[model samples]
Structure formats: structure tokens, C-alpha cells
Target chain A: MSIGQETVLEANEARVVYNEDSDNPVEAVRSISLDLRKGEVLALVGPSGCGKTTLFNAIAGLIPLQGGRVSVGGIEVEKASGHVGYMLQKDLLLPWRSVIDNVTLGLEVRGKPKGEAKKIAQELIERYGLGGFEHSKPSGLSGGMRQRVALMRTLAFEPEVILLDEPFSALDFQTRILLQSDVKRIIREEGKSVILITHDIGEAISMANRIVVLTNRPATVKTVHEVPWGDEVTDPVAVRDRPEYQEMFSTIWQELELTNGQQGKTMKGAA
Target chain B: MAMATDIGEAKKQTAAPPAPKRRPRNSTGRLRIMAYQVAVLIAIVAVWQIGLWTGTLKPYVYGTPWGVMQAFAEQIANGTLLRHFWVTGQEVIIGFVIGCSLGSLCGLMLWLSPLWAKILHPYMIALNGVPKIALAPLIIVWFGLGMESKIAIAAIITFIVAFLQAYKGTQEVDQDLIRLMKSLGATQWQTFRKIVMPGSVPWIVSALRLNVGFALIGAVVGEYISAEEGLGYMVYYAGQLYDLDSVWVGIFSLMFMALILEAVVARIEKMLDMEK
Candidate 1:
């Protein structure tokens, strides 16, 4: 707890309940507290349908929490409107729009003048290896290219913290690894705080400086591990080759399996 | 020698198959289809002429091909057909403009206000369910036997088709895109303009294509009931007088007009890039 990192985002005892008053009310997240530090990538890893996404949504101010609070740069998150940059599992690029137009979407929504937005979008596109595709439609781009465009779009808005909800899950295995390093490098260069929600443990370990493992439904943080790889480990691919990678992977896997076993036992007892 | 033969056989098996032959050009296929259509039309006209010459068909009842052509020429020479064609064309154009605008506007309004849509849903269904041709008499009575009645009828018919198409299109827009826009801090109006309106362009164009036919139907139906001038009136007058050739001329003119309208709508759809 005394790692001496400056906190960029904090979620305190955050709780989320769906259909609060209905006959079959469901609690998705329960009293989860965590901190995201400046210039660090925090990955949330858990079982499927474990409310990791729900927590991400709460942190992004997309959904109202029943209790507790989420703050970015010490300011309370009231709503999603211009608060956090969010990337969903799908690219969600507008098909009718060209690549540059889609990238400038956030700026356009903010009412930035067209010329200024286009200039910024053009620079981002060229900077991120998406040059020569400024006018191509989203349909024409490959999956990895499209995701890069989406990332560039989020970056263009310059939010305090970025919430990535399984942004690489839809990509192929090779592309996922490549993008993992690419995104990590870009984010590190920008020096932005990010909270990545991922089901893939390898992805979590590869990209994140810290990982939070959570329990199934009504999810709570089961454990938090700080990645021990030092500053020399700049590339995600290089980090995977280190001798400590397998050990860390197995440790997190065991933690996940423990929760799975507990849930299985509970189901058996009920049946 | 046996080993060499086996190697050659293996290579033959592993080699890629020959590429399939390319199909004939699409333009050639289209030309062939057109030729067949023309032949069918010529054959039908030839049979009609032969039957008339053999006295097996009554020219007064079915009308000979030559007689129909003569009637067409006579009408053109006298300028009556041109006048009637102009009247019907005017009614259709005015009615299409009014109907398309109102339908698109109302459809957009309903999309923005679901409460209004729910309240008016049943009434819309009821209005659309009634055969618009049945309303011809009432329309003429209200708007009179002039071009006003024809235009009114055409407008109502076009309105129903256009409204339904636009409404469906608006409803079917990608929810994900809307959510993305909202997350970007877009206001409700900006979302509607940038996402909803552009998304519905295909539906609006399709509606325009369908409404062209509806507009023509409404105009002709209104003219059939009571009108001083129009192709429909000519048809009705010719039928009453047992001038079958003149009736055929009127029908052909309406068909030709419909084709032209459809082509114009298709061109507009292309310009809008609705196919993309």
C-alpha cells in the first residue's frame, strides 16, 4: 500500500445494483475500492460476467453507483460526458464517416472548429502508423487498424483517465499481442493513466503495471499484484520473455481458479 | 525409372487446379435479355394483327395493333394527348413534392417523440389500411373535379408509403453508434443530425421510389372519378365510347410516365450514395 505512487483515479467502496427495486434485483459490483496511479496501467482480471465491466462503467461515470464514489484527479465523477475516454469491445466507428472524420468525432462533439479538429486528427493518424488511410471508410480497414483508429480517437479528446473494456478481445491472437505492445507504448509516451478491463490473464500481465483480480458476480477485488518487471521492460513482448513471466501468470491463474472452485462448491451445496 | 514416375505423379496431385473460366460479360447478358423482351413484344403485336386480318378477333372489342397506333398518332396530331399528359404530370409532381416533405417531417417528429408515436400508432395503421382508391370520390367532393382533387389524392397515397419507410429506418439505426455519440458529449440535436438523419437516407430514397408509383395511382384514380382533363379521363371517356384503341394509348402513356419517375428516383439515390 506504501508504494509511493501519486494517485490519478480512486474508487472508494463502489457498489452497483441493477433493477434495485424489482422482484429479481441483481447486485453486479459490491464495495470495491482501488486506486489508479498516474502513468500506470491497471488491469482488472476476473471470471466471465464478474462485473469487471460494470465497475469500469461506474469508474467512467457511465452508470450511477448505489453507494461510494469514483474520483479522477481528485474531482468526483458525476457523468460520462467528457470525463473519461472509453473504448468498448467493439470499434464502434461510424461506417458513413471517413477515417479522419471518425477520429475527429470527439472534437466535433465538443464543438471544436472543423479545421482545428481535422488538423489534430490528421496528426494523430499519421503519428500512429495510420497514414495514407485518412479518407478510407472503417469497413475497408483491418480489425487491428480499426482498433488503432479507435484508440487514436480516444486519445484525441485528452481525457484524464482512459477506461478500456476489453479493447483487444475482438482481435486475433497475433494482432492482440502486437496491439498490446503498441497501445502500451503509445499510452506510456502520452503519460496517461489507464484502467484496462480484460478477461485474458496473459494480456493483463503483459500490458499492465498492476493487476487486480476479482471474484465472480457481485465482484470484489480478491487480490492486487504489482508487476515486478522494472523500467528496462518497456515492450510487452519483451516482458513475456522474462523468466518471471510464467511464475506471475501461474500465481494469478491460481487466484482465479480459487474463486472458480469456491463458486462451484457453493453451487454443489445448493443443488 | 519407377521412383521418377512416382515423383511426377505426386507433383501432379499436389499441383493447383486450373482456374475456372470467367463468365460472359454482364452487358452482353443484359443485351440478350433486352433482345428477348423486344421479340416477345413484336410477336404479341404480330399475333394481334394476324387475328384481326383473319377476322377471328373483333377489332372493336380487343383493338387491333394498327388501330391503337393510329389512335396514338391522331391524339398526338390533335394535341389533346399532350394537354392531358401535362395536366396529369403537373398533379403528380406537385403532389409528390408535398407528400414527400410532409411524410419525412412527420416521420422525424415521431422518431424524436416516442410518446406521440405511441398515441398515434393505431390511427396511422387505420389510415394506411384503407384502400386509398376508395377515397377518390370523397377527395374529389372535397377538393373539386379539377387538378386539386388529383393532387390531393396523390399526396395522401404517397404520404403513407413515405412515412412508414422513414419511421422504420429511423428506428433501425445502430444503437451502438448512438451510444458512442452520447459518450462523446454530443447533444440530442447533434446526434440526430449527424447519425440518425444520414442513417435514414436509404429508407427515404426507397420511399421516394415507391411513392412515385403511389402518386401516379392516386392521380389516375382521382381523374377516373371526375376530371376535366388527364390521361385517366381520356381512358374513362374512350372506354365509355367503346374506343378500345384510345384506351390502350392512355394505359401505355401512364406506364411510360411511371418508368421515367422510377429512373429519376434511382439517379437521385445514386447521387446520395445510399447504396454505400
Candidate 2:
């Protein structure tokens, strides 16, 4: 990963099953085992409704793991509260709060002093391009601006690892590409480890150091691809031009198609 | 990195055309509406005046507008109308505040326990269905014939509506926001304070609007049962004495009071909208 050999996050055969005690239990995540190195961007790309969110929730400790362990910095996720900051696809900004207030939400919930939290949040706002819009409410901002505030909110808490769940899936293409570049720069500058979840192969190829492909529901790791471009390549457009990006995209696309076909066969078998 | 340039470009593209301005409503259209309202009032007054002059209506029974105006002048001169106005105003305001506070507090507390909410749901619905005005006599008996009775009636009337509204608001707060709070390592109390309370504001404001009117009803009903002062007592006393003009004056005063309270609630709603 270029920064260190130390692992920041590890998911060892972590499994999640929904309605486990019910008559018909659904296995969402059968098994996922992966390690995220320090200062690395790892992307988990899977088909739609393929238990990606289930895995994300497990890592965030929002839900309990049915079996096995998901740990952050060697601490089990369930015990490691406030160690991982999570960003959802939707910005989920508090409409009543101003930009600065939303950014400091994590700190406020953490019971940090108001003045100290505001100072920390203020630096992030000014350092980013949202300096003048500190007092502006979320409704006044554009979609892209809201997402930026969401990122700032995640970053303000200074968690050991950040999890982004399809952070750009809501944006239009033009806004998405520009934001992708902006986010990459911000994460790189802060030297934060991130686990990005998306269904977009192009996004995974452009952003992550290592891309983990996942199968359909009861998701298991299909393949893991290491991007040839190193940390120096943060711009998505630049990454797309590289021969490696094109080659890796097709390979992942084929793997995903195979998983979808297998899922249909399994459904037929059940019926 | 072209971070600054990217932001500048993004701002330019996403700056959608300021929502079409609403045309300032056209002064002539506003003036026309005002003219129509005044014309309607003039027509009603003219019809009443003509009827009185032609002897189609008796002045004693169907009191003339001029007689009602004279009654208003007499009350103002003697200062009894103002005294009654102040008494009713105090009862309405005090009862509304108490009822809204206690009711909403109970309603919000219900959110802390689902089992309690389930247990109390049917009882709350049944209690609300019992016409509170019917309990005015009982309320008068319990709280006495003074302003306390009127205040008690007002509080009782408004309490249930406020309770129902605030409870519904607590239930309706976005579930995703709660999930977000949990992910942030927030305790249940923190989630309630930051997310649930603020999210419930729109519903609570609606309750305030509805309950202000309900509080007024309770106060008037309480005064109807037994009171020496208040517009309701004034109207009842005038009717007993066959003073039609004075009765009309009391009724108009009550209408004016309701309009003012409604405007205040509307102003609060506007302020909340702007803040959010």
C-alpha cells in the first residue's frame, strides 16, 4: 500500500444473517474476509442488492455479526465504537442545522466541548472550499455541496477508518466525476484509510488501491484486483486513461456478470 | 490538484436559475381582492340596515348594527367589556401554555417506551372521543366557579389534541436519521434530543395552531357553565337580561380574540420555517 504494512481494519470470515430465528431466514452475507492496510483506499464492488450494505453495517458496528469478527485497529468492531466514521449514499444532513453545525455533529454527539468542536470543524470548512457558507443551511446548498459537508462531517471526528457507502451514486455524471476527484484529493491529504462500497466498476478502479469483487446475496469475495497506478494517481480522469484501468474494468465486469447468472440459477433451484 | 478550479466550475453549473420569482403577486390583483372583501362587508351591512328601516326585523330581537355599536361604546365607556376581555384572555393564555406543555411532554415521553405507548393507545383514543365540553359542568364542580374552572376546562380541551400530535410527530421522524445517529456512536438520549425533537417540530407547530382554538373553546365553555367575568359570561348574562346589542358585542369581541391568537401561531410557524 506504500504507506505501511500495518493493517487498520480486518474482517475475518464475518457473516450476517437476517431473521435468523424466523421460519425462513435469509443469509445476507455468508462470509467476507479482508484486511485494509493503513493509508489505503479499498473498494468493495458488488451487484445490486448483493449484501454490500449488510457488510457495511457489520463493519460500522451498526449491526452485530452473526459469526466471526470485524475489527478496526485490532479492536473488535462491536467494542470499537467511534473508531470508524461512516458516510451514507444520501448526505443525511440535518436540515435544521447550518453547514458548520452539521460538520460538528459527530463531535457534539461524542460530548466534545462546543467551542473546541466548532474550532475543529471551522478548519475543515475553510480548508475545503465551503468557507463563506458556514452559516448556510443544507437546503440552500447544491447536491454536490451537501455531499462535501457530509464528508467534512465524517472527517471532523478524526476516526481511524472511514467507510463510504456509494457516496456518489446520487449525483449526476458531471457532478460525480468532479466530486470523485475532490474526495480523492481530500482523503489523500488527510492520510485516512477508507473502505468504499459501490456497484460501479469504474469508480472502484479509479479510487481504490485494491478492489474486492463480491458475488450476489450471501455475498462472498469473488476476486481482489490491485490497481497498477499508485497513490500518486488521485485524479479519476488520469486513472481512466491508463491501459491498466481499461483492462481491469472488463475483467471485473465479466466476473460480476457470472455472479448474476449464478444467482438466477440458485433462485430457480429454490422455486 | 485543481481543487479550487473544480469547486468554481461546480458552483457555476449547479447554480439553478433562482426559482422564477413568483411575480410579486401584482398590486392590482391584491387591490381587487381587498375591494371585493370590503364590498361583501358593505353589502351585508346595507342589507341589515335596510331590513331594520323597513320594519322587517325588530330592533329588540334582531339588534341593529348601530345599536350593537352603541352597546360597544357603552361597554368601553363603563370599562366592563375591557375587564371581561382581560379575564378571558388570561384564562386562554394560561390554560393553553399549561395544557400544551404537559400534553406534549407526556406524548414525547411515550416515545421512550413502546410498551407504554401500546398500553395507553386505546385509553388515549377513548378519552379524546369523550367530548371535553360535556365535562364543563364537572370541571366547574372540581375547579370551582372562578377563573380556575375556566383555565381547567381550557387545559383539558387542548391537552389531548397536543398529546396526539406530538406523539405522531415522534413516530414520524425519519428512521434513516436515527440510524445515522446510532452509527455516530450516539446514545439513545442524544438521538432523541438532536434528531427526534427537531424533526417533530412541524407536527408540534400544527398542534399549537389547532390547540389554541381548542383552548379558547374550553375557556368559553367553562365560562358558560359558571363565571362572573369573561366574554362567554357576558354573552350569557346579556341574553338572560334580553340585552341583544350587548350579546352581539360580546360575540364580536370573542371572534376578534380568536383571530389575534391565530395570527400569533402562524407567525411562530413562519419563524420555524425560516430557521429550518
Candidate 3:
């Protein structure tokens, strides 16, 4: 709403269709447009099968758009662009690799010298409380710690925009809240912009500066709500304690509830 | 058995609850299983020994276990067993290295080129379907009646096995991980090096494990067909002379060689951290 902040990522009428050549082609995302501002967390929330992941993949340039464009730093995104770092729902850490090796995978793939990559990975590991677990495998780590390692890996490359696709969903509620705060703090401290895709309204309200709600399949932008949090409440767990957090959560919940009801009625009518 | 069960029940009752009974039970199970295996082997040997001593079975045909041991000792004392063992061992090792390296490399190449993979898929399947031991005569003809023929036969067998496994390994890599690597701006080579290669280590190690026996089979078969040396030649020579004890010695030596090679491959798998 304000022209004060800089836009780091912009998606212009992005469209995605699955099995486009087949007779039963499914349109996953239908012309959704949004912007990720500099140093701000933008959460995209929607119901199941809403193509939030499809949009996230498009933004990350993992999939080509049927229509419109997604760009970071004014450069059009393409497959394997390295302009943005993506953390998927699953940690996707290489089980065979040690924590440090897994974290520095991107750097090594990008052809950074091994010593330099390890140094960068080491610093991130120490900073993110994964200090002593450097040589440990992903199988040896707890779910939350694995996610932390995943986050550190995403940050190891220091891309302009980070795309998180339900990164904390697999964790227990307590760990999820704690990790939300940790990730928010780390992202903010590093001055990186993030586009977080989640189905959890509370997570969206607590972690993001702006929340983009989407409609069910053939997903389109429903509405965007700027989180009404004070500057002092940076921690997601602390933000949850604020009265505004609940109010915003209820508001988004109602929006989702209405969509669910409509879908139920439509299904019943079909039956 | 009833008395033993009662004593076990009494001990269980006396033992504190939640005292980690699992450890002792597991150890006992392992010990019992090992004892049963040893007993089975000893019983078979004992039966054979009794039959021979009672003249129920001819020692000339089946050979006495003691006679086999004596023959083994005689060969060892004269260093003939060691000489033949070294020759066969060298063939197996050299063939395994050549076959595994070339096979995995070819597999990777095919994976990198889907067109080549498509073209070669049927041929590979056909080659794999053929019993590689049947190629012994052809191999001997091509490479001559020396260790070269044995090595060639070994290499061919191991190559087919390793290639198929490595190809399957490459295909089985997680597509999600590939996409993740691609999103990181990794080039194709980078993805293959950092993700595909490391991911396929388990499959490659398994292939290597299987190839160990295959290479030995190839070498032994080659020697059976034409070689003047090797444990296979010893078996052939012993069989021709009706020296069943020496034949058993040769056969046992080949089995021992296979087990040792498999153990080495397993150790390498452990070093690669591919073992589950």
C-alpha cells in the first residue's frame, strides 16, 4: 500500500497448467499477481489443492509459466536461475552428507572452492545453533534441527529472495512456533526477502508482514492483508501474544471457512 | 526342556521388571542360531566320515573329509595351492576393477544420453539374459588359454551386472532432489557430480558386491574351459585323475576367494557410508 519499501520480487499475472497437452489438463494457478518487498516476509495462505506450491515453484523458476512473468531484482526468472533460494516442505537434506556438507551443497554445486564453502557453511551452522552437529548426518538430527539445517542451507547461498513452501508444516506445533521465530529473526538479520507459502493462518499472521490469501483450485489472489504488528514485536511467538494476531487469524480463518463451505455445497450439489 | 523352562521362569520372576530383557534375549538368540549352524555343518561332515570309515560309501568317489584336509595340507606345503590361488585372485581383482570402472562409466554415459540408453536398452537386456558362463569357450578362443582369457571372461560378466545396476541406480535418484539442485542454478554436470553420483553410491556398491562373485565365476569358468593354471584348472585336473580330495580342496578355495572379495567390497561400502 505504501511506496516507501522496495520491491525485490514481482509476479505479474502468473499462470500454471498441469498436463497441458492432455485432454484432462488441470489449471493449477490462474493469473495470480503479488510482490515480495525488500526485507519483508510475505506469506501465501490457501486451502488444500489451491496451487500455492505451484505458484511458489513458478516464482522459484522450477516450472515455466503458461502466462505472465516472475522476476527477482528486475531479471526475469528461469529454470535453475539461482536468483532465489527455495526451502521445500521436506528438509530435502542429503542423508549421506554431514550437516556442514549438506548446508554447503549449493555453494559446491555453484563451483565455490571447498574451503570457502565450508567456511561459509560453518559460520551459518554456528550462528544458527547447529554448532556441534557439523559432522552428524541428517538421520541423526531431530525434525526441527533438520529443518534448521535446511534453512541454513538456503541462506548459505544468500539469494535476494527465499521461497519457503510450507517449511515448518512437518514439525510439531511447539517446534514450528520456535522455528518460525528463529527463521524470521535469521531472515530479517540477513536482510533477505521471503515468500512463505503456508496453509496455517496463525503462521501467516505471526510471521509475515503481508499475507496473500488464495482461492481453491485454479487459484487466484483472494485478498492481501498487511499484518498490523507493532515494530517491537519481531518474534513470531511474541507476535502471537498480541491481540492483533488473533484478530487477524480469525479474519483469515473466516475467509477460508467460507470457501470450504462453498466447496462442500458444490460437492453435495454434484452428488 | 521342562526343567530348563521352569528354571527360566523362576529367573524371570526373580529378575526386576523393566530390567532390559531384550539385550540378553537377542544375544541368546544369536548364539543359538550360530550354534545350530555349526551343529548342522558338523553333522553333515560326521555322517560323511562315518559312511567312509564303515565302507558304506567309497572314499574314491566322495572323498573322506580327512583326505580332503590332507590334500589341502599337501598342496599348501608344496605352495602349488598358493600359486594357483594367486593367479585366480589376480584375475578376479583385475577383472573386477576393469569391469566395474568401465561398466559404471558406461552406465553413467547412457544415463546422460537418453537416446543412447533407449537404443542400448534392448541389447543390454539381451546380454544380461545370456548366462555369461556360456561365453567361456568364446572368451578362451579370443584371448587365448592364459590368464587373459580368464580376465576377459571375468570382465565381461562383471561389466553386464555392474552396468545394469548402475543404470537403475541413476534412474532411481529422487526427482525432487534433482529439482532442488536445478533451482540452485546447478549445471547438468554439477547436478550429476554433487547429487546423482553420490546418490547412486549405494546402488554402485551393491553392483560391486554382486560383481565380486560374477568376476570369480567368470575366471573359474574360463579356467575350466582352457586355462593351464588357477584353482579351476586344479579342479579340472583333479577330476580327470579322480582325485576327489584335491577337487574338494579347489572348490573350497574358490568359495573362500569369493567370500574374501565380497568382504572387501562390503568394507568399501562401509567406508563410503552407503551401508544402512
- Output the number of the TM-score-best candidate: 2
Summing lDDT over every window of 10 consecutive residues in candidate 2 chain B, give the lowest-scoring window.
B12-21
lDDT of 3 by residue, A94-115 (tens): 8778999999998887789999
> Which of the two, 2 or 3, has more lDDT?
2
Which lDDT tens digits does candidate 1 get at residues A1-271?
1223789899999999999999998999988999988888899999999998888777777689999998889999777677688887899887778999989988888989999999999999999899999999999999999999999999998988888999999999999989999999899888888899998888898888899999988999999998898445868888889888899999999999999998899889999
**Which residue runs does candidate 2 get wrong by more than 4 Å?**
A268-271, B1-40, B50-62, B127-130, B237-244, B270-276
Per-residue lDDT of candidate 3, residues B64-148 (tens digit): 8999999999999999999999999999999999999999878766667767777776676567667778888988899998899
Q: Best to worst by DockQ, what's the order? A: 2, 3, 1
lDDT of 1 at A81: 79
The regions of model 3 sitting more than 4 angstroms off are A1-4, A261-271, B1-44, B54-56, B77-79, B274-276
Clashing pairs in 3: none
| Winner by DockQ | 2
**Residue range A1-271, candidate 2, lDDT tens digits:** 3556899999999999999999999999999999999989999998899999989888888888999998898888883267888888899999899999999999999999999999999999999999999999999999999999999999999999999999999999999999999998899889899999998899999999999999888899999999987777889989999998889999999999999899889989999
- Per-prediction TM-score: 0.87, 0.88, 0.87
